[model samples]
Target chain A: MQLFRGLSGFSLTPTDAEGRVQADLLGRLLQRIQAAGVDSLGLLGSTGGYAYLALAERQRAVRAAVEAVGGQMPIIVGVGALRTDEALALARDARKAGADGLLLAPVSYTPLTQEEAFQHIAAVAEAGELPLCIYNNPGTTKFIFGEDLIARLALVPNIAAIKMPLPADGDFAGELARLRARTPDGFAIGYSGDWGAAEALLAGGDAWYSVVAGLLPVPALKLLRAAQAGDAAEVRRLDAAFQPLWHLFREFGSFRVMYVIAELLGLCQLEPPRPILPLAGEVRPRVEAALQGL
Target chain B: MQLFRGLSGFSLTPTDAEGRVQADLLGRLLQRIQAAGVDSLGLLGSTGGYAYLALAERQRAVRAAVEAVGGQMPIIVGVGALRTDEALALARDARKAGADGLLLAPVSYTPLTQEEAFQHIAAVAEAGELPLCIYNNPGTTKFIFGEDLIARLALVPNIAAIKMPLPADGDFAGELARLRARTPDGFAIGYSGDWGAAEALLAGGDAWYSVVAGLLPVPALKLLRAAQAGDAAEVRRLDAAFQPLWHLFREFGSFRVMYVIAELLGLCQLEPPRPILPLAGEVRPRVEAALQGL
Candidate 1:
């Protein structure tokens, strides 16, 4: 099994006035992710694209991402729901959409035991027959995947990798070490941290998913390339260059802010669907300034 | 407009084998809600039986609750979604199901701004044409309904109540007081705290919603009625009586434990839907013992 490497992040579609899929903007986002030289295309994950899209909309997103990459890069699509049946349905949709693999995150409505987590993954594996990356973002899921759970999941078939975003703060180093130790040889482990991308990469992460890569691909890809080459000096240089946009996103929220900055940079233009409080009057300008600085 | 008083908890449907809606159990649940003398019934909200059910199952849950109540008690249903259109559709469904009111909680898939929150409530209010309680459970919604946001929502048509849950273990006493102060004369505020219910009731909550109430209505109602009457001594007595059950729920997890305890008591003999891990083996017996104590 090959480990997923380099930068990978999802860009979401903005809904239209009629509440239908904004297909064109989504296609543009796929182009942007490709231009960023992303090693893999992550579709339908929470960074923007997948959190609230309907089944059909999600399918459209997956297809758009794949089509934009023109089969050059693999697309990892997110499939999650409170009910396992619904999640199974999503897995079916992901497969039908021609996704290369699946990214599964347990829904937060119900907590899962470590054993159940293993079972949940196994069932999805059986249903979809697709390679999987267990997405472990505890803040969103509210259930942390402990070492025992990772060890159990490692033994499950068709689990290609793990996309882990440790909370920026906390004593997560121990958990990180445990994860690294427990991850099976065939399964790759990737990191997702707005600020800690470089550090995680330095600390043995195989890849870092980048939001900046959605809008500014070359610089992000350059950073990933440098990090993979074990050039700490060049990695820092690229990290410094991307720091302005990073600081802007951190100033706002992680998921929504990235959407706002993407819109500001002309990567794609559309409003986030309702419920994400929009960036205030001065904030968009601030994002623009940050984008310019970057 | 009138303040929502009495029990504002969900009137859940009992499901049968194959995960289908058990109309008989649903009817029985509604009858029990009425027998318990709860002032209001919330059907098809997250807890009221639709969380695991299919769209048709959810509609049946609403219809069953409405018919069982037979216009004897007010019914407020939760209509939330990751999509605005879906939430609007649910609101309209609530109206057709003969709901007395609607409970609107913004879904995170479409994260709402304060203004969008107003728009969402306004759309639902116009569609349902019923009294509404803004269910502010930040734990589920991922959006905190602050006093200012609540103040803005207070202007929405037919918004009759605010079901605000205390956030985290933070110092919300001052914020609660502010929320109450900002409420217009016709609006009421209720509480939902599995372990903190007694204390939350004492802290100016006009009424409270309880999962425990579904199984043990007599005791749950008695506790709340005592708390409402400002008889601290009676409140203590009833709370002590129910304390073991409450403690078990808190010590274990929410909802799943509630469902298991219901099954143990023969109130609702259904296992929790998948993705919600059941109680640990040792924890199950403790819950059983606590129910026996009750």
Candidate 2:
């Protein structure tokens, strides 16, 4: 119940100088995250290293994260694909990799009906005994999940949480009212309100999927710890420093934004695979300036 | 070669009493389409059936169609999926199922760059020796085949045609011009321009997909044959009678409108599967009245 309760950094894809999955680098990254003392780690998520990797590559990423964390923290692995069978396969692999749970987003490419969406979640739930967290990133999938669908998914036994990409204007208040009313208090509700994390956390959310937590975990964790303690002053102060990084995610595309920020801060240096163009060259200077300014 | 010429009917999916794939009914539908003397048969496309059928169901639909036509006509199957490997697998299966050719839509779900789109087409083309027609239905897939992408696809070996869904506005005209400049004259270029079949045929397309042909093949083929003969008078007369069907397709939902017309005319009695809810019950009578009036 309420398994995740702090800033959960969606980890990046770890790569060596040769641009392959660098297990050592991943282990180091996990150690760094544990040092920052974030509540949890989100591996192979959209922000984490998932879509960019092949199934084997993704498996390595998940396995490395689990082994590196060594029970120091819980890890939520992203399970997304086009086929129900493939998504299910990934869920099983993640479970085998010792992930604490899965973050299941609807398969990409085909638009799913409410019934299909419900069936997809059920399939993933049955594939693994691990607790499942439904991911709602409509911007990437082009398929928005209605409240009715979410309510239906809440009934699936293994579904323990929902990590929703909050809409800009009505992120927390509207969804929180509906989800809190339908879902039991035991279920983790993560607000991927992205930039609006501090306000949303204050407004009430069990955890957050934070891009900032990947590089600046101490500040991100401090903000969440303060929010949990009802320290608005601390939350506000951290949010201001963190606001610039959030702004970068908004200005650039989603997949490559974090990697660019990572390269700038010397936290990690890895290029996204082809088909995902890098963040603009100009944005790099601004990211450096923002990190320094903070 | 010009595999599909003149008007082709995108056949409807047929389900049995228990609401499973009814091969017998599908066979009948294809037989009727062939007996009706339309130029080609489009099976397993968006209009042929729902978008999210399982791989087995898709293969069954294709087999049923091919068996029913029994080589009496050209059967073009649509093989579209999100994964490169899955789509290629479908292409190979379609070839074995004895389909005359393949019409591929870009993989659904993920946002694709132009290079990914080109690679998808090339991969499918390489999968089988059968002639391939790239289906451009941006309305459904949220992918627009830009001029450069189309030009690159034009050079893809075994890609024999383009099945473009023409927008209501003349937006496809520029792309058509660009394709015309890049492709040789004998290359087949068809339109899934349901409402504007006559106009598109007049505009130099080798063939067109027709939902209208399913219910009123006599009228649809009359219009096509007349247009082919340059008999403007006969073409206008048939178009006038058929204008009600075209207007219905344009004014309301085409899938529902066409299915209702098919049911009313006793072509395929089974209704669309769930989530693709039918036209309102009250609208059915009006559709009936319009069909009778036409």
DockQ of each: 0.45, 0.16
Residue B203 of candidate 2: its Cα lDDT? 64
Scored against the true structure, residue B99 in model 2 reaches a CA lDDT of 91
Task: Please report, in order, the local distance difference test score of every candidate based on alpha carbons.
Answer: 0.71, 0.75
Top candidate, metric TM-score: 1
* Residues B26-72, model 1: lDDT tens digits: 88877887787877776766565455666667777778777787588
lDDT of 2 by residue, B144-186 (tens): 8886787778778898888877755765556566678988665
**Model 1 CAPRI rating:** acceptable
Local accuracy of candidate 2 as per-residue lDDT tens digits, A72-178: 88888888865566677888998888888888887544356667678778888889788888888776666688888888888889988888777557557777877
Question: For each candidate, what TM-score against the reference?
Answer: 0.89, 0.69
Candidate 2 lDDT: 0.75
